[model samples]
Target: MAEMVGIAFAFSYIGDAFHGSQIQPEVRTVQKDLQIAFHKAKFAGSNPLLRFSSRTDAGVTARMNVAVCVVKKSVWQKMGDLRFRRALNDHLKDVVVWAAEETSEDWNPRMASRRVYRFRLETMRQFNKPHDEGKLLEMMKLFEGTHDFTGYCRPEEGRITTRTVDYCKPWSIDGRLVGFEIAAQSFLWNQVRRIAWAMSEVALGTSSIEVIQEALGKGEQPPFFGLGPSKWLTLWAIEYEDISFTDKSGDFFENLSAPPVGINGRQFEIWQQSADHEQKQLLLNSWLSYL
Candidate 1:
């Protein structure tokens, strides 16, 4: 037995391709697929445990997510980091492992320094109500700093609903409102999505900014803001305090083709479904290039 070594790999995937990042029975997931690829590539040791840095929901894309896998030390040293990445990528589909490096055996992926998320309102049909950049910015600033996000998240039992948002701002491109970005050391479930719903409502005149203000105000009762669709959300990055991963994604992005095309209206419903998926890929690739 060649001792075991832990290697952390940074990867990205189209959210719609799998049920979610965690492993689940029957349905496919990012973790499950990665495990299968590891088996195929012989990258894992006996009963290896793989863990992800962040858990993203179904239909939510990730530009970068970290996961640690335990592999035989000799195998790792012989194959090296870049080759290890290729081994995984060669056996995976949709999910791309772009970077990898050796890390401490007990490395905890969840203890990240900061996690950044982005929600693209323009890509969501429900937020079609007219909105302007100025209004979006104004609505976004209210979320900055510490606030009780009770009304802005789907609370987990026994977990405190109060959380501090490091920063919140409108993410724009070419002078157009793309969506919003928010960062924190950690977040409650659906916190960013709920916040996006509130900001869009206020900017589009569906609700007043005061609704959000009241939600954050201490000792004040908050109202529930609707949850935004997961499809428009993306886990942009996860920063660590002590670990750094080298870029091993040479030509990976360059080799990616443009978004898939959708058929025109022969079967209106099918065409619309195809078009929706196409739009998501387009937006996802756009953000990927920006990274």
Candidate 2:
């Protein structure tokens, strides 16, 4: 039996173009693109065992995500990390492979130390205002400890809804209710968005804090507050202990950064500029309704 090498890469993707991170038949996804790239590179057998640290839904962007794959040692040494990244990028569109490193075969991205997510809510509407910072902070605190998050997530058959949330809090950025940041080891499906929806209702005075408490205390699902729009949410970061990623040039990254080594950094800058321009135009269009 030939020895295998574990290859891990840090990647980012603009979610608008992808159906989701997971693979589905006849659907475009991050995983599907990556698998195709692997096949093209001849790095793995017909069916590669590619694994991702987090599964993002449609329209949910990610600043940093980790993926791990195992390939024959001979193949890795021959192609090298940098060349491998370049080959992968050649086949990817919205996804960028920024850094790579060697890892143990037993490593699993899902067992991450911490996972942080950000949910942004515009303050233009009454529902987005925080009625009382102190009171809202208190409500956010209720989610800090271990609790059955049955109310905050969609029910999955034979899956436990109980999970520990290390931190959950609302923060304002430049006087706007930017959104809430939540960190946990793992989360239930739609958990963060649903929590944000319930919190927004409380802030808007449409729902009471006691109602949230009742759901938390009773471990029961609350009436649908409505899942926040996926576009406003992002998987901000995933943390692992003592693992570092480096580019093919042997340049080590102190932290997970954007525009990975094989990618054209200027392209991302231009994309952001175009996105900002479009956003401003949309805001102006909305204002025209008032006139």
Candidate 3:
């Protein structure tokens, strides 16, 4: 019997196309789709041959999520990373396997060095509340460094809510405040979404900084700011030690020109929706270009 090897790959998907990242019975999911694609590609291994670096909720797109699949060493040696990626993508639907590399047989994608998330604040305009840029950036900085994020996250049994945020800052595109970016070694479920909501509230003057301070002060009773919309959230990046995938997706960063201005009312709402779709398509196209 040939020994089994692991191949790690970076992929992107339109979250709207699936129920979520994890597998669920009687419903479509990223993992379920990957499993089917793997089978179609003739990759032989265990029933669940893949391990994901992170999990995302429904309607949450991912620019770069990683997974490792176990396959016969002989097959991998013959196919190579490029062919392996192409084969799986050939069977994938709405999922682009952009980059891949051979990995240790025991490699675990969950043990990542860092994870990054982005929350599109422009989506908040739908509420007719334009945020104060300075206030938004200020509130985001408060989450930096280590703290008990119990108030900013939905707690799960047997899970510690305390976590470290490496950095949190405003993410601008073409001089326009489009969103915020946050990075951490790991995060509690819904942590980023909750933080986004809190910052949005403070920036809009609907809530005060005191509320955020109280929430981060480790109080017995913490304040709640609600969850942000998942559709505008994306798992932007993940990093791992000793293994790296090249950014074969050509530079689309500079190509994202500043959005148009001077539009308002129902027409502006339509533009917002169209703008989001445009961004998603640009990302998808970039990844596909590597194939």
Output the number of the lDDT-best candidate. Answer: 3
The full ranking of all candidates by lDDT, starting with the best, is 3, 1, 2
**CA lDDT of each candidate?**
0.74, 0.72, 0.80
Compose the digit string of candidate 2's lDDT tens values, residues 83-169: 877878877767777677788776788878888887754421333233655556677888888999988888889999999999988
Tens digit of per-residue lDDT, candidate 1, span 41-155: 8757435689889988898888789999877778889888678878878888778787777887788889998898888776544344345657778888888888887777777
Residues 1-291, candidate 3: write the lDDT tens digits. Answer: 778888888998887898989989999999999999887777654464789999999888888899998777888889887898888888887888888888888999999989998887776553345557887778888889988887887778999888999999888876778778999999989999888888777887878877787779763224555788888788888888877653444434335434456556776677668767876778777775656
Worst 10 residues of 3 by lDDT: 246-255
Predicted structure 2: lDDT: 0.72
Ranking by TM-score: 3, 1, 2
The weakest ten consecutive residues by lDDT in model 2 span 248-257
**Which regions of candidate 1 fall more than 4 Å away from where they truly are?**
219-224, 246-291
Error of 1 at 285 (Å): 6.7
